[model samples]
Target: MYRNLQLLRSIRYSYSPPKASVLLDVSNCIQGLKQKLQELNELKVATARKIADYDPMPKLEVKMQEEGFVIKVLSQRSCQGLLVFILEAFEELGLDVLQARVSCADSFTLEALGNKISIS
Candidate 1:
């Protein structure tokens, strides 16, 4: 009978669940960090998709050089008569285009070098 009691006690002690610690729960912390990281990754992907779907307005840049002016224009979408409008504006400004590079296949891009025309 004493041997049976001893066997029960040993079995109970060996098969018992682990006691909770007073210290930090490292596994829970790691699991929480993993969840947060996954959430951040999902957010990052959503932000990137939003940025890709965004269509920016046309952009223009001009720089004054010693000899002339360098102008660059970009349009994400093709416009029907944007080139003519640009040329007319240059004419109104009394600028003569010395050189130009244009692309209109998918988008619109224009790079031009111009100098002020002498009135004389």
Candidate 2:
């Protein structure tokens, strides 16, 4: 009968496809994950470069004080590099760095000074 044909056609069209919004949500999720992966990759590369450039043996002069000690160093590297080195040195010495001061001249000279405080 004609009624039976119409009912079958309705059921067939009912299972036609998913909504466009669902597809858009899936696409957005994929793009977000791709962006996160790219950021992680960039972080990995930067960390690797820092590790490679690190110097394990830099000259350190320690001056004893009433509470703690002061550290000094002289190097022809960038101020940023010296700062990183000084922080790592404090970590190795099992001391806490209380404050850091850096001075430099525009004529290609860099000076890094750090004050350390003992936890004990």
Best by TM-score: 1
- Tens-place lDDT per residue, model 2, 96-120, is 6665565544212323334454475
**Candidate with best lDDT:** 1
Model 1: per-residue lDDT, tens digit, 1-120? 545544554544443333332112434556789999999999999999988976778889999999999999998877889999999999999999999999988889999998999987
| TM-score, structure 2 vs. true | 0.36
Q: TM-score of model 1 relative to the true fold?
A: 0.56
All candidates' lDDT scores?
0.81, 0.59
